[model samples]
Target: MNTLLAEPGTLTTSPIRTQQPTGPRIEVTGRMHDRFDEILTPEALAFLADLHQRFAGRRHDRLADRMRRRFEIGNGRDPKFRDDTASIRSDATWRVAGAGPGLEDRRVEITGPTDRKMTINALNSGAKVWLADQEDATSPTWANVLGGQISLFDAIRRQIDFTSPEGKAYTLTTGDMPTIVMRPRGWHLVEKHLTFIDSSGAAMAASGSLTDFGLYFFHNAQALIDSGRGPYFYLAKLESSEEARLWDDVFSFSEQHAGIAHGTIRATVLIETLPAAFEMEEILYELRDHCAGLNAGRWDYIFSIIKNYRGRGARFVLPDRSDVTMTVPFMRAYTELLVKTCHKRGAHAIGGMSAFIPNRRDPEVTARAIEKVSADKKREAGDGFDGTWVAHPDLIDAARAEFDAILGDRPNQVDRQRDDVEVTAAQLLDVHVGRAVTDAGLRDNVSIGVRYLESWLRGIGAAAIDNLMEDAATAEISRSQIWQWIHQDVRTDDGAPITRDRVERILSDLLSTVERFDGDRFDDAADVFREVALKEEFPTFLTVGAYSRFLVDLA
Candidate 1:
């Protein structure tokens, strides 16, 4: 590899960083905690500030472009493949820098927030890749944000272990550990805790995406390469190729600044948004030198569809969240197109989360959920997916078994070109759920949205409710579906119109009966659910508003 760092340093078992970056001063507003110094070093903060100053304007313009395109879609425009980038899609000889070390056999990848216990458990769970999430699966509290980085720093060096408060011990298993692939917050978010003053002497919030990426890269890029693994990422909620281009620029600039080799980094873009699905090939093309694959971020994809088409009338009215399965027509087209696009470009196509959590209290229910997860993985493997995601450790073996049956001894199935797969703009827009929506489904949305929000408000980003791992993506879909159904004049099975009043009543009833923990925030959760769900306009994300209102400078 022969990569030279800007400041050469050795990684030890201790969490000490030895690197530097020169830039303007950044004002950090979040309360500083013990051991936060290792992750938020002056060099790291300087690097983050420099990164922010360099690209802040471009990020602003990209966000504005998002609103512009979304307004066009809202005003009767179906998203289509761009005519300008047709050459990039049609160029047959191009391919991504495929599978870095430790990333070759990703038959089963486990995903979760990068808390200490989870870091140990995921490394020991035997999955090929651990999506060390600092995005949706993690609430961006100051403690959480810095703790995630510290845990990853320790985990990468095999110095991470956990002891429960009740005296339970956990450690990483011997032999091969899963490769670490970090997912930072998407382009839309900001790290309000850290602020950098710009050229005009105005303070600006540092972009969350850049802060996470820059700190991790400045600290770990060289160490990772020296240890046979390269710095990798899973980019979430990217809405366009231009965004991918921006990321490409970041990766390029990062490698140069850090004195790492060009293309030493790899990223898999999540085809999660409605606009992103249309530009799958173009996205892969843009980051070809650094792109490893594309993932079917199914839950968020559905949320994006509903959000863009919320006011477009009946067509975009997604049925109950339960009804929008991967096998449905519109979703099928999206997944299939993703596989075909990735394979053609020599990138691995990873599948979405098998979101069923184990119910240890009831063996029969757990068995049923496992069966469903197995079937979902089987379908993905059969349809030529290289790997899939499982939220709980119990389902890792089941997911791997499905991929094992198909992959046998192969590292991946990127060779299985789904040439016959052809997706059109209309097929992507065919999201109608013809079957009747049930009252159970409507009530379920309220229950899930409020419960998930309660957990999120309490500094938990992923929670298990009714044996399913509910993260921000799932919560987004649940709330957005409620908004769509209510505004579209949707009726349930018994022909009851789904109105804001009915949904609010359900929220009120659930609160009265639901048991609360010592620190539960059901009232705040309900308020957020109400604001985001019943409001006339759409919110880009639930966390954005809630984070500003409830999370920053927490008491």
Candidate 2:
């Protein structure tokens, strides 16, 4: 067998180098981008044409200004909430002072989606909040749609416990559940099917876009609020602080128009976009008064990083997908930023969902997975994340158990009473885009760029290589890109299985070096790597990036 094959970058799906559009893409006022691009491919010409059609005569500034006024951002601060402090601390520069109490005293609240009956039961259970998701977890067709809507109504009417739509006996006793939350689809195809059930199997509503979804959601929330129900939403795919800010403004307007208090509405922003990572603090500030918390939205964020950046070339510079590290320095930087930011403002730092689905067919597999996920959740909770989301019902017990075990009976154990941490544009740029790297290390360094540049954009912070955060001062240079190119040969070195242990060791060593400078925090982080090492038995964990595990494995 040949020792060297084509570079990951060279493996193109198409023969031609497709044209792609760059940033600041246009959006036609009151129109969906998908509508204009339905007939075009993702190439340059299509993107350019779409850009022309979408932004040629639109007034984006008008929208931005309208949103600013609506949200009442007086002098760069959301009016509803006063800043606790005037200045934010620089990254990782503060000393540990002394070892604080074990974070196990803190707690996170999760609202899991059991079967519709179980879901309703979970909602009314003592969990802090439950998000009824309409995307990702649900099948895109009909049954789930009806089930989702009915579940919402049932929860509102206090009728969730009886039998499921399928007629199995189930119910939610009042005192045990958390507050109900709705995670609806974006301005995507699902909205059309949901808002208007077509008698002839055709949607009566216009195909919804992101803006349209907001309009629809706000309208429904207004109705609910008028009827004395809560008006809260979990905003997913937040691409930037500006976007989250936009939602804040929308929420405020909706409340005012509905004759409710301006800050009555709450939103939890999902950092699913690459751009949102960098502006996380700003996004949080924009929505702080009404923010439930922030989620480390992993799958979509990774997909965005690949599509927006790496999709330009055919072959990836990084070895196999499994070679990438979430426990790397950039990710640590992002997580640490989130924890500190949340702590500074008295908001919760909710970890992302865990992707490890227990194999029910194998008891041993399931047990090991539960134990590993339990440990991970503990570490995250210990690190200050208040809660996490889970995809499967089986994992819910483990997740909640970890949280309950960690939190016990403390009422205000979560330090939600603090001043806002001020971070400058230059300071942010220094952590992400300002970092320098040579062309020779573009591939490996791309992850650094992804974490610093993209994560910031996603409002998540810089989630990248381990060495990047080893010092008190931020590095202007990115080693991941350079490291990738230099280590490219080693990645493809013959006959090495891309096992969990290998990836764990690589990340552990790298993270160890970064954590060394910070003392106990580094030692505490080892438990996460140990959990990752245990995931070798689960192959799916490797393929899908298992990003949720990184967040949920907080214990």
lDDT, candidate 2, equals: 0.43
State the number of backbone clashes in model 2: 64
lDDT of each residue in 1-555, candidate 2, tens digit only: 101111112211222323212222221211122222221113322232222223222224433543454234213332221133233233433221111112122143443332366475566444555666654443222334334555565566565666656877766656534555566554222222212212232223222223223433433455556444456666765555555665566566556645667666666677765456666667777676567666776556544443332212223233333233345344455565676666665555677754455676778867876886787677676666777765445677787777667666653224642234343333322212222222223323323332333222222221323322210001112222222223332333443533334545555545545423422333333343233223222121111122222211110
- Each candidate: what lDDT? 0.87, 0.43
Candidate 1 structure quality by residue, lDDT tens digits, 1-555: 111112112211222223311234465567667777688665676677668777878988999999999999999988898999888877898888888888888889999999899889888888999999999999888788889999989888888888999999988876788889999999999988777666566767779999889888888998899889999999999999999999999999889988888999999899999999999988888898899899999999989998899989986777777888898899999999999999998899999997777888899978988899999999999999999999988898888899999999999999999989989989999987677778999999999999999999888989999888999999998899898898889999898999999998899999999998898899999999998999987787888999989889721
Clashing pairs in 1: none
**lDDT of residue 174 for candidate 1:** 61
**Model 1 CA deviation exceeding 4 Å by range:** 1-23
